[model samples]
Target: MLAEVQADELVSVDDLIPDQAAEFVSQLSTVEPLPPDDDEMIEDETSENLVEDDSDRSRPVRENGSIYFGECRLLNWTTTAKGGMKADLAILDCPADAVHPFKGLLCGKQNGQRLRVWFGELADTDVPMQVNYQGEALLLRWSDDSVNGMNTQVMLDDGPDGVKGTHPFTGLPIGRVEGHRMKMAVWAINDDESVIDPRKVKRKVPFYQKPETTQAHLLSRRPRFISYVKRHERRLTRGQEIRADITIAPDEYIAEALYAILGITSRSELGDENAVGREARRRWSSLVGEYFDDFYGRR
Candidate 1:
């Protein structure tokens, strides 16, 4: 079982990370020659007495050039009654190829006790109104509920009566259009036009591989959405599933999002051979091992 986060921080070292696991990460840092000690006394101390801080020392290494990939599981997760239908649910899908820098893990109460993380800049794309779903330009506000780290779900059925951007998640007025593609802008806030977007923010990430189990997870997610769309959108009953494709500004965004969602890289680009999927699965196993090792070591 995964450790649960207490308060607002990561799980206590005793619960989440074990001493052996911590030592392993420390060993990796030493092998990789991570940042040298800045404190004169600590630098002079013998290895026997040196204590590891495990601070944000990994930050600079990320900037130096490390690619992060792989997906993270929301272990021992619980959901609100409204989202209970998705309870036994899992989703494993990634966008196009993208790059992201490594940001150390995030352990939070809401996100469970552990979270593997990375950082990177997202590519920029002008999603003209024509290419957007339906025919209107919709200004989207990224509420926490709608946008997960690399995944964003817009409830097409839940919006204002007439506005094209009206969302069912939250009843908000939206601007409407009739053309195939319309131009929309991402703003800091719903009304504010000046705040820069995080998608515009740049960074690099580790390249993680996808797991074969994820294929099963994907099959799980696809069906749930299909069922939901079919039940909610009467028009979709014509044997047509609601199509939603994951896209990023740069190809790197795809990779980054995949890593964020699945905590693994994908062999989708490689070939349809089961081997490719199997390889992705192998990588996921490695990642899980590393994650647990660090978790136990820290404890």
Candidate 2:
């Protein structure tokens, strides 16, 4: 019976001899038991430790060095050393919660030459106007949504009625505004020529009606305006370039989000497969990563 059991035979206990059954039971008791697995327990403890460490430490936070300005108004236009007109702008609004290392006005100039002749008229009118300059047609519109009453926006290859037009400069297909759209407001000049008191004129009013003199001051909070101008002036005197560190990576979701944010439907419309497209994609990725990190990093 023991030999048959060792050969894998299905033998009943009743068929086994008493001494054989006793020997089988004794052998079973002598066999060693398998060790318990500790891998699962170790893994659980490691995960718990990781969660505790994460809870104890805060994620590193850094600022996107780019300077952003909202409710911007053109405070003044002055002649630069190269005879080009330099526009001083007041940043009336910004991300209030953000840490702005560069808090001030932004000066803009083009090609060491005076701005296109129509800019003066546009500034003076402060109303929606279409003007043809440098073989390109541009539509300018004013709004008062930013502050009490101050804002200006420009659209290219489109009229005041929001109708698309053929590109005046390219003669290629035109779809929407190209390059950076300027959102700006012109400074309001006082109408009364005899009254020189700057205190009497409010800075929040739009410049629709022509004033007696061309001289004008920025229409924003006095303190903020002064501080902005001073900061820019100091930077200019010191000859320092404010460096903005931007980082970007190639990501499909980031690209889609950027397209929506930029109000564009097709990536091809943005000159895909070209240098312009590559740069746009890079910038969009950087912008998304900087402003909307949660969305950018979402799985």
What tens-digit string does per-residue lDDT give for candidate 2 at 240-278?
332221123223333333344333445554446666656
lDDT of 1 by residue, 1-299 (tens): 00121343422322322332333222212112123444322221211122222333322121112122222222122224342201011112223332222122211223111111121111223221111212111221111222333321121212231224322112212211211111111111112212212221122121222223433233223333223333433232233332343332323433333343333445352234466555555554543454345436742
lDDT, each prediction: 0.26, 0.26
Q: RMSD in angstroms, all models?
A: 25.4, 37.3
How big is the positional error of residue 117 in model 1, measured in Å on the Cα after superposition? Answer: 25
Best by lDDT: 2
List candidate 2 stretches off by more than 4 Å: 1-70, 80-83, 99-182, 185-299
* Total backbone collisions, model 2: 0
